[model samples]
Target chain A: MSSRIDTKTKILDAAEKLFAERGFSETSLRLITSKAEVNLASVNYHFGSKRELIRAVLARYLDLFMPAASNAIAELQQQHPHASLTDIFSALVSPLLTLNSIRAGGTRTFLQLLGRGYIESQGHLRWFITSHYGEHLQSFVTAVQASVPTIPRADIFWRLHFTLGTVVFTMASADALIDIAAADFDEKNNIETVIRKVIPYIASGVAVSA
Target chain B: MSSRIDTKTKILDAAEKLFAERGFSETSLRLITSKAEVNLASVNYHFGSKRELIRAVLARYLDLFMPAASNAIAELQQQHPHASLTDIFSALVSPLLTLNSIRAGGTRTFLQLLGRGYIESQGHLRWFITSHYGEHLQSFVTAVQASVPTIPRADIFWRLHFTLGTVVFTMASADALIDIAAADFDEKNNIETVIRKVIPYIASGVAVSA
Candidate 1:
């Protein structure tokens, strides 16, 4: 990569890590620049403000994540024309589970960041998300509608909203809840276990009638 | 109210509002005191530190919210010796729905704060909540167990955790989603509608088999 691009990538990587670990509000441009080993001028040049920087961070993830999800849906459509609700949900979530496979970034941390974007409307993140990914979200909604033909679109949306809640909340709180489960419930839970557990719960939730 | 008590209430109210709106990390003691019309010394005199102050705010909600939940369970136990899964769910959720009836606080704001408690592990809030509310939580767990006798305790807890994520995530993002639904889907969603929509979804989730 050229120096200019390398500088931008470094800043993005540093921001993503810090935002995930320390949280968006807690992570500062100074911290980000110092970690990235870039100057304030570069940070300003690349992303004008912390708000825009945060949007850029999410946009990076969305760029990677949404394509994988959209492809998953497309593949499901071709392979299983009569896909079940579970299959559609699996397609929606399985790519996220692969975030653990990437070595450079922390999967749970990235998941936490993504979950926070959806759950907490802290900045321009929500608007950035809806406008950018609205069509992709609606496509998933359409996929879900086809799977559960009888369910009302409103019911599907409401349940899907509930499903998003479960995903975001569970992913965001994964590490803490893992420890708490061990300490309080004497049960050990890893990320895979939690996802394995959550999928059916969400599928069942979506399938259940009002 | 006496001056001392008035000062304390003012501090608590301001802290809760700021924390909900700006988040725990983003909201500072200086901002809080200024908003409360109190002084720095008074914040120190009242809550000791921001961590403790956050815990105290949550404890306030638990004081009001838990008893209502516990009482709902008790009433279920008395009223229907054999309450169904939906009944147990209704018992657990109906009290929280009534939190809207009280005018002192915005239900969505309080719910956002509570949801953030579980989603984001800001300071010592997670441990504070688990330790304080563990027994009451276990009681609700047991109530769900009775309703869904076939499900294992571990599965119940995991599902219950998922259920919580759905509740917290949905409630925290209620306002943003309401607008998005209005804008993108041409639908209207409110706090009450969200609650009514959420309960059945949770009940069905908790009852689902692994």
Candidate 2:
């Protein structure tokens, strides 16, 4: 049982790294097996297929992130029922940053995986996330809606999506943007700094009156 | 001469459609040739390579958009002398929508292509746009800076990128979102309506106090 779990983990680690660095469709299962140093049979045994492996890789992060983010928001709402949009968004930061503790660059990796998943896999990943974590996502959306009651739910819907686009696209290209920012502005930044920078922008955008 | 131009336009039309619908890396010269009903030699003759073809496809829209957007901003500055950030952002709406006049579904296609280009090509498309249309971009950035004099340049840089991500990601997935909105919220949104919806969100985000 331990050995089986070890093989599963080995496949996931190699898969996630490749998926994040390259992309889903571009990263083949053969390369993943080679990187994991496990044969084809091992991947098949562990994850059933490449698609399942992709889901598993993402689930690893989402499993950790969703509950933590939900808990953080829940805690914030309990403490400060009238929390501002920025405050609500800021609450997610700690949960997001804690991802780095799970792996060397877990936060960045998870986000990139997310961006890639959404962009590459058509609606499969979206369906997977929503079906699995609908309640958690709903909680976050509900908190934003509660903060801005005046905005219609539909407009809130659109704006929240806009906010998602901001974070998703930003995280997808975070590494390149970081390198460029460092070269052009002499500003050395990591994933945390970039995440912090985006919160205000998204918070403000989500709360803006339509 | 006319036949050559026709063949080139034929290739571009087919290439853009496939590239936007699928993606840059997913669409191949052979597929584009098959869709265009032209030979591979024609694409090679016209664009030199797939990378160049992608650039050409984007450049077609940018050539029209960059100047029109700049001129719109220039006109806004000339007329108002102190246009607000919303007004500055709103100025580009006409230019963006004007893309439709050039082709059916052109606005969405151009935006989708831009999103795909940025996401797929790593830094190549970014480099192409900046190098080719640097002045136009700088002017828009300068106008934005003028509106938000209080915000730091670096903050503006970050926010503008946030804004780009918002627009890019939103448009990339606009078709799906529109479908969902129609089904769930009963909101019928075309590309124009979506663009208008995002303008306020981005304008507010761009000008928000740091």
Candidate 3:
């Protein structure tokens, strides 16, 4: 990458890591600039303000996620013209599961960022997410409703909510939970195992009647 | 209440509101003390540290939640000696739904605090929650497994993970989602509606097989 692009990437990298660890308000611009090895002026020049910098950090992550998710959904729809609810659901979530596999440390960081976004309410990232991805979520909800006409629309929304919570939590808190429940469970970092384990539970919940 | 006890209560009330609005890190001891109309020395003398003050805020909320949830579960177990999986599921969740009915601002604050704890990570409140509520979760899982024998234990764990995410998100961000979707629907603040809407989706997700 050119020096200009490298600076932008470095700012994003430092911002994402710090945002994930300390959240938006707690993290200082100085910390991000120091970590990125760029002058303070670069952040303001590239992103305008710390708030915009936070938005940029989240946008970079989402830009990577949205295309992959949209393509996976499109491909699945084509492959299974008469796909069951489970099939569509799998398409929607499987891409996220595979995100970690696309690169080293990518999945862990993504999951961490996601969990932080959902759990922390006061961050600028929250506004960015709702504004950018709210429509995408509505689209997913519409597709699921179309696939499973029997399920109530309200229930569909709620199940989607729960499914997200579970996915983000498992990704972010798995290591800690594992430490707490130290039993005969395998210690593998298999993302597939996580996906397979969660999909059914979410599927069953969404499929069941109130 | 005695003057001393009243002052302590005021401090807690202010702290909870501030923490919920600005987060634990961004909200300062000075802000909290001033909001409570107590002196800086009072905060130091009463709570010893800001960290402990945060814990006290959470502990007060959980103290209300834990007993109600436990009682509801106990009542359910007694009422139906052979309750189906759905009944068991309702027993576990219904009490939490009722938490919204607690005094006007209480539920929102509680939800905010819970969301903050889950997302922020590395806190005494998080430790307090997992240690106290971990077994309750495990037992609920066992009931779920017994009811749905076909599902694997690992899958149940994953579904639970999703269920938690959904619940927290809905409780914390429902207003935001409602605002965003205001054109499509009326904004109502009924917690029962939320519970009724969510239960079946989550139940089906957990019960259905892949």
lDDT of each: 0.78, 0.89, 0.68
DockQ of each: 0.62, 0.69, 0.57
lDDT (Cα, tens digit) per residue for candidate 3, span B20-64 = 777777788888888887898888788888877887888887877
Model 2 lDDT, full chain set: 0.89
Candidate 1 versus the native: TM-score? 0.88
TM-score, one value per model: 0.88, 0.93, 0.83
Q: Tens digit of lDDT per residue, candidate 2, span A1-210? A: 334657789889889999988887678988988887778798888778888899999999999999999999999999999999999999999998899999999999999988777766666788999999999999999999899989898899899889888998889889888988888788999989998899878888887877
Cα RMSD of predicted structure 1: 3.1
With a 3 Å backbone cut-off (N, CA, C), the pairs that clash in candidate 2 are: none
**Model 1 interface DockQ:** 0.62
Q: What does candidate 2's lDDT look like per residue over B1-210, in tens digits?
A: 334558899999899999988887778899999888889999989889998999999999999999999999999999998899999999999999999999998899999899777777766888889999999999999999999899988888889999999998888888889999999899999989998999889988888876
What is the CAPRI rating of model 3's predicted complex? Answer: medium
What's the candidate order when arranged by decreasing TM-score?
A: 2, 1, 3
- Highest DockQ: which candidate? 2
Tens digits of lDDT, candidate 3, A133-152: 87665566666787778876
